[model samples]
Target: MKGAALDTPHIAFVGAGNMASSIIGGLIASGHSATCITAADPFPASLERLRKSAPVAVYNDNAEAARSADIVILAVKPQIMAEATDSIAAVVRSNNAVVISIAAGVTIASMQARLGPEAAIVRCMPNTPALLQHGASGLFGNDNCSAQQRDFAQRVLSAVGITCWVDSEQELDAITALSGSGPAYFFLFIEAMIDAGQALGLNADIATKLALQTSLGASQMALQSDVDLAELRRRVTSPGGTTECAVQSFEQSGLRKIVATAMHAAADRAAEMAREMG
Candidate 1:
């Protein structure tokens, strides 16, 4: 909290990769002081990139940076999460810091196994859009977490975008399927729309522009409007209109069923991954 507000707790990042850099940049841009932030990564390239992102202190050793931090963000890959957590497990426990992890499939149980049963840990699943400050994060805190720690976790994630807390850790699997892997679904839809537009005779550039704008505008409408999604769709599907014809085609092709199957598959895979990681 050296350069930040008096009440702001010192935050340390365990990794300095792209996602960590993005979150650090957003935090500083929002209000957190660069003085209150710190990062540790073994690679000089990674630390250099993080230093470029924010004016935070850098360290080559994990414990050196996490030594005095009030919150430690685990931003490493799932496969290496155990090793990363072990590196700073003592510091996290000694400082009694709230550990927030952004690695998907790294369960709280797995972290507790390394940090101890009484350790406060929050597991989060954040999609790539977080780099653009439009992310949706799903968080689940172990029973050891306090109310204040939960709020702090929410604030940290909110610097990137919105956050939702799951009542049970198990629900995070579905949340992962919905928002964690959700961006790719939208991207695929946008790509399909652009291709359709091009096939319908529009040039690629124009089609791409139109498709992106339409997607953005429609999302804004859904977010800002008070009406429900089904009602909004009904408004566009006028009887015997082109939109109606398209809707009919989608229904005839069982689009809803297709979506359900894909989402369930994603959720199941997420659960399987967690088990595999452990």
Candidate 2:
């Protein structure tokens, strides 16, 4: 990417939380100008941490930060998203900035109502892993968003990790279930594995180290291999071996069904949140 194209746009972050800071770091690493980035947060400590890594301006007023920005990222929590967006809605629209929101369950319709119909908006779900620059995000843009606006949104989120776009706003709920809340499921499974290892007489530290390394190695292998995940798993499970016995136990216990039920519950709750937030 040309440095001029990346650095020319002025970006504003409405919240300076960890995820927001991660994005700022990424944009800078991507050759964006730190002077062109501004972040707003109520807490001085958050701003302090943000400035420790980037030389961006910090503001206590959301409107001030967003007024001249070419792109405005809404990184505030869902509970306070309305208040945050309402504070800068007029300025953001006046600036003709592309508003990219990472707050989950806050619908585009809800934002449009506050920011006016002409506001270009993108709604995205990015997980906490963004802080480590390993996040995955799902984005859905309103009709008012131009192709340029969509590209800008993609560039911003892709700074942290991978990004996928969904056809409809409703599909974002499914994405929220699959990738947005998926990390917690993996962590839970890792915890169970560690406990099982400990029960089998491995020390806690050793078990945790082994589980973490195995998770990392398996993920890297999957990413680097051409084979499908099921094939990869099958390759490790010899017939009538210990791995096969464990796989059989998991299958008999309806693990797939349980996982599906949990994911569906997450999607349902995401939909519920949209209604409640609306």
Candidate 3:
């Protein structure tokens, strides 16, 4: 192939915050050339911090960074997503760049309104754990996107963590319910565990550390185990034992129903946000 490296799609980041930094760090670590990336941020301090972390070109003007790029990543907060995308719309349309957005609550239609109807956009939902390179991302591309564009979008997100593609944009809301808001659910459980541990006589510090570590260990165990989660739980809860007692209490208390209700609320809210934004 002629100029294989030269053909690598140039990518521009519309915001240089924590998520952007994590994705950039992962891309560089995975051998994607830093030279092919550019980032724009209003704050000079944020730009400087990004530069310190990754040696990519930084710009104060979104258009300047995005101009003629093959891909543009929207990494700003949802509240500012429209303004950030508007600033780069002309540049993106001129180059026919594939737009990959990582912001929650912004839909493909809203983006197309800003970037023009023919704009190729891939909407994504990624959780906070992405900062630690242990995140899950769900992506959905609009009709304007080519197969290659979708693949490229997946590759960019896969740099940070695991990614799965959904058939419809609406399913992104389910993703929001699960992987998107899933971390907070786990954290809440840990908090409850910590408080209960303290009530049971462990010191505050000891309770906190033990709860956090146990959460981590359990997650790792589930991830590494070949058996299904229900089977794993059965193994942990021996017949007529303390674990069984706790498990029985949880089931009797309708814990599963509580979790189902919470996830449904999250999905509904996600859909509501998309509608409001749309």
What tens digits encode model 1's per-residue C-alpha lDDT throughout 1-278? Answer: 22123367889999999899988988888898898899998899999888776889999999999988888999998988988999999988888888999998888888999999889999999989999998999999988888878877898999999999999888999999999999999999999999999999999999999999999999999999899999999998899999999999999999999989999999999999989987
Instruction: Judge candidate 3 against the unseen true structure and give its global Cα lDDT, from 0 to 1.
Output: 0.90
**Better candidate number, 1 or 2, judged by lDDT:** 2
Please name the candidate that would achieve the greatest lDDT relative to the true structure: 2
Query: Model 3: what TM-score?
Result: 0.95
lDDT tens readout by residue for model 2, 214-249: 999999999999999999999999999999999999
Model 3 lDDT per residue over 235-261, tens place = 888899999999999999999999999
lDDT of 2: 0.91
Looking at model 1, report the run of 10 residues with the lowest lDDT sum: 1-10
**Local lDDT at 100 for model 1:** 98
The positional error of residue 90 in candidate 1, measured at the CA in angstroms, is 1.0
Provide the TM-score for each candidate, comma-separated: 0.96, 0.96, 0.95
> Which residue pairs collide in model 3, if any?
none
